[model samples]
Target: MDDVVRRTALPGRSQSPHDKLARGLGYFSIALGVAEMVAPKAICKAAGVEGIENVVRGYGAREIATGAAILTSHNPEPWIWTRVAGDLADIATIATGLRQDNNSKGRSALTLAALAAVTIVDLACANGLNSEKASRKTAARDYSGRSGFPQGLQAARGAARDFKVPDDMRTPELLRPWT
Candidate 1:
């Protein structure tokens, strides 16, 4: 199924803004995961939390897995949604740090704010992917004559066949809408 998705191309379909953002999120996740894994002590220190390097590393692993999944999947909605869940978990962890005696309250607050910003992006991407998927499904159905496009396949084929071209438009590339 994954191979099929990677191989198939939807004609005349451009990448939506949501798709771009989701891809960006995938990259961001990878970068963050690397940081968490390679510099857990620094991350903990900056977040004003102490003695949680192992926990930070575990979160890093989760981030890397989700990020890789998001990057590879043709339909990234589920993986993006998983990132949202992870964001919530991160926020919870930071909140706990705020209550700890050794933690810096100000730093914890700032971390929470940053996580909130990330959560917003995660949610927007997730919703966008969901809507995009739905529209694709609808388009597929219409193309297959299951719904929409009243005359369906026959009408489509006829339209294509009947379409006239100028004498100067000799190339197939010029005839294709996607071009």
Candidate 2:
């Protein structure tokens, strides 16, 4: 015989799923960009896209910019969309390696596949961000009518006029004269 399992509701989340994904992707972008900048030739060899060292370095710079922007922006949706565009650009550039002249079609294909996957993630994150933004816009409340005080202004003023401190509370014995 097996014991019954108990189920519980999940606690509140500090970040939305899209935000978490975006943060992870931002870090990944910076790391990959650094690798591309530091060793463009190695990256090209791995992807089977040779003779584009300068282009790879430029892409690396672009990646770093987008990643930094995403991490620092107050509203990251636009930055995430920027990453999606970057992915498309990368996919387009890598597809060139599929040419008949390039012998490493397998590696290029693999690279393209990976880019496609990343692009999908970016698209999802961007769409989620947009949804969140739309919901926020619709959910805004008007707090302008609120007065911080619980009582109305006139009442508060009247109470203050009649205010009196209790004897014990007015001065603690500890801070009194030592006589």
Candidate 3:
């Protein structure tokens, strides 16, 4: 029947904060990766690191891959976790730079601090995603076919059929006691 159309959640529904953050990180990764790939030497020089242009370009590639994953994956939790791993690697790289007897120790330290902040955000977003997944799993098991509506689908359909709409209210007329 025409009235029996199936109802489902919309695909273009509003995104949660976590989703927005993940998307933002993905965009950030792509931008940063492009910058690094395009100007690895310049980046390293600005950061006070030396003789690691190849390494910087390698990191740029990794960032591009991670960003693409985050942008395209339906569940970006794993990708975000990967970002956390990348952050750790970055910290290690910066630490190495810090140990170098170059003038870029201060810049490396600042970079490390920034990486720490990004790591925190990545971890928080990953945890939130995991919790949301767990909650969905739990909710799916909460309702069984035989529990709430004991009479089953037919009874539910009958209830829906029995539901009445007041004609006056449908036309936006003044409310009055039903006689």
Candidate 4:
């Protein structure tokens, strides 16, 4: 998106300690993303996906939200809250698109879902449910396991890297997918 739109769409890019903290996560995101891009085999093994890594690398808010639903509906962790928040935001965004007059219902739904993902993340962090660092780290760790989802963590990391997600977006402290 254009700078103006990106700046306008979300919260201000203030340089407070909080913003700095979020940027700090970017390193983690980058590492994961890089690992996924560079070494899918090792990452998949670490995370447990003979084929799961490719599927996970394709994740967006919708996928994360679905995972959250499964977690909440069945097996939840304290860390699951982070995914929940992200999912909610994705839903909210989809809702927003549905409300717009000119947008296609389908297109709006997708956009709304994406928006919801980011917004849920914003809410979660803002509400003290989780700090950005803790939340992202938890997400990285939980998602990194190869058993359930293989390449996803790596994919997320790669996405962050491709987008040049700031440090806050990376979350590098989490263990790497491969050694």
What value of lDDT does candidate 3 attain over all alpha carbons?
0.78
TM-score of 2: 0.71
TM-score for each candidate, following the candidate numbering: 0.70, 0.71, 0.69, 0.28
Q: After superposition, how far is residue 88 of candidate 3 from its true place, in Å?
A: 0.6
* Residue 58, candidate 1: C-alpha displacement in angstroms: 0.6
RMSD per model, one decimal: 14.2, 14.9, 13.6, 26.9
> lDDT scores for all predictions?
0.82, 0.80, 0.78, 0.42
**In candidate 3, how many clashes are counted?**
0
What residue pairs are clashing in model 2? none
lDDT of 4: 0.42
Give the per-residue lDDT digits (tens) of candidate 3, residues 55-171. 989999999999999998867889999999998987887778888897888888888888899999999998987777545322222123344666767667757677678767545
Candidate 4 lDDT over residue span 18-131, tens digit each: 443334323333444455556655644443224445543533423434444432331122334444554464354335445556525666555555546555554444444234
Model 1: per-residue lDDT, tens digit, 116-158? 9999999999998888766534222112425456776566766
In candidate 2, residue 76 scores what lDDT? 75
Candidate 3 has its poorest 10 consecutive residues by lDDT at 1-10
| lDDT: the better of candidates 2 and 4 | 2
Off by over 4 Å in 1: 1-8, 11-14, 137-179
Q: Residue 28 CA error for candidate 3 (Å)?
A: 0.6
Give the winner by lDDT: 3 or 4: 3
Clashing pairs in 3: none
Best by lDDT: 1
